[model samples]
Target: MSLMTTLMLAGGLLLLNGAAAPAETRVDLALVLAVDASFSMEPDEQDLQRHGFAEAFQSPEVHRAIRQGMLGRIAVIYVEWAGAFDQEIIVPWTVIEQPADGPAFAERLLRNPVHRMGYTSISGVIDFGIQQLRHSGLQADRQVIDISGDGANNTGRTVTLARDEALAHDVTINGLPIMLKRPSSLWDIEDLDLYFRDCVIGGPGAFLVPVREKAQFVEAIKAKIIREITDRSNPRSLIQPAHDALPTNCLAGELRRHQPTAR
Candidate 1:
């Protein structure tokens, strides 16, 4: 059976297994926080990223944004990913409607140990995000995959194909390109933000915030979350239309990994 068919069957099974059909909760947004835990991310960077997210939820601004939403709530799941098949859901679907919900979610997120795995797979995470959104069992006004990574897609299916698939489903993808360290190795791309702009993020009002300094992590995460919750365009972010020309190579990560280097 096709993946879509399987998903439909699984959803049906949930209702059939229950005493009564569970009413799907309605929220302003259903968000997947798809984070990178690839080996390329140093231990310090990993900790910083984790704390950044945890703190973002605790911030008053994010809470205020949640309050101002049409339904005054959002459902979110936290996922850490690396390689084609390496994806772990650190925090399961949690609805954040009240002031206490955000902090509770953050605490649960921090309780999990941080881990790093092999390869960088933006495509893998996107595909995973799409599946999770479909199976989340929450009705949302908007669905988004908020991806933050230090590198590009080095494994799995083509990133653009996965991105296009998500766009077809009306799932918006936003990006956070971590550029703290200068690009010296082949694994690193100097124009990662551009790669995200031309390759990764898509759908309505998709944008990216490039993190070049260590100090910006907390603020960046908070700002991005607020913008997403409000579903508004931010002037400070690098907003790109879906049809923009590809200036940076979409296949740069794959090429760097597979093809032989020049003499």
Candidate 2:
């Protein structure tokens, strides 16, 4: 064979071999980090929330948890949500398989500008998170939606409806109720943690890490992420559990809006 022909055949073989190799990476879990960006959050609060996540992803504890996973890796995506139609994917799906991947994930998180808009639609973001999991491409033993919000669902169809849908699909939903202070508006509920426990989170191993103070945001987020990465079943061990069987008005947000205010 001529020299040129021999080289061409070798190159073609190499290309074919590369194409046949599997490109997908397996992980222990697939997580969607859904942050609430409703108008209730002040600009500084938004920044604090974003930074808290960034710091958590960079923390040694979280990285350690990732490495301890069965596959030693996990796929995560960051999303910001507001009204029923205002869900945005801040960071696309990324796999973290090593310590180095943690900082890279943190960098991407901090580089993006935090957005705030519309009303608080917990149901909308849960639906969006489910969609993301379906299209993540990465195979995982566990699928989770880490939803953090300060208020109740006021604009969406219903939070319970969405939560049930996700649970039915075998996707676990965890909550981070930001109850740093009193309800900002009538639509906001005083028992945000109870709302999360009874209505927002579902599926096996579902739990919440409530942030009751601004100073606790970072530590709370870090602990939550670690627990998630490790697939811990009992989150109450990490944080205080909400009151059991507490009556929560899931439709409180809508009710307040429709009812006439007493003069």
For every model shown, the clashing-pair count is 0, 0
- For each of the candidates, the C-alpha root-mean-square deviation to the true structure, in angstroms, is 5.7, 8.4
Top candidate by TM-score = 1
What digit string (tens of lDDT, one per residue) describes model 2 on residues 1-263?
Answer: 77853553332211111122123546799888999888788788889999999998888888888889777878888889999989877766777776777788788778888888888888998888887777555577999999999888888788999999999999999999988778755666877888888889989888888888899999989988888887767724435555555578899877776768711
The CA lDDT at 158 in model 2 is 89
Model 1 C-alpha RMSD vs. true structure (Å) is 5.7
Task: Evaluate residue 27 in candidate 2 and report its C-alpha lDDT on the 0 to 100 scale.
Answer: 75
Off by over 4 Å in 1: 1-23, 236-246, 260-263
Over 1-263, each residue of candidate 1 has an lDDT whose tens digit, in order, gives 77854654433222211122244878899899999999999999999999999999988899999999888988888889999988887877778877888898899889999978999899999999988888767788999999999898989999999999999999999999999989988888867888898899999989889898999999999989999999898666464435546478899998889767611
Q: TM-score of predicted model 2?
A: 0.86
Q: After superposition, how far is residue 23 of candidate 2 from its true place, in Å?
A: 5.6
True lDDT of residue 207, candidate 1: 85
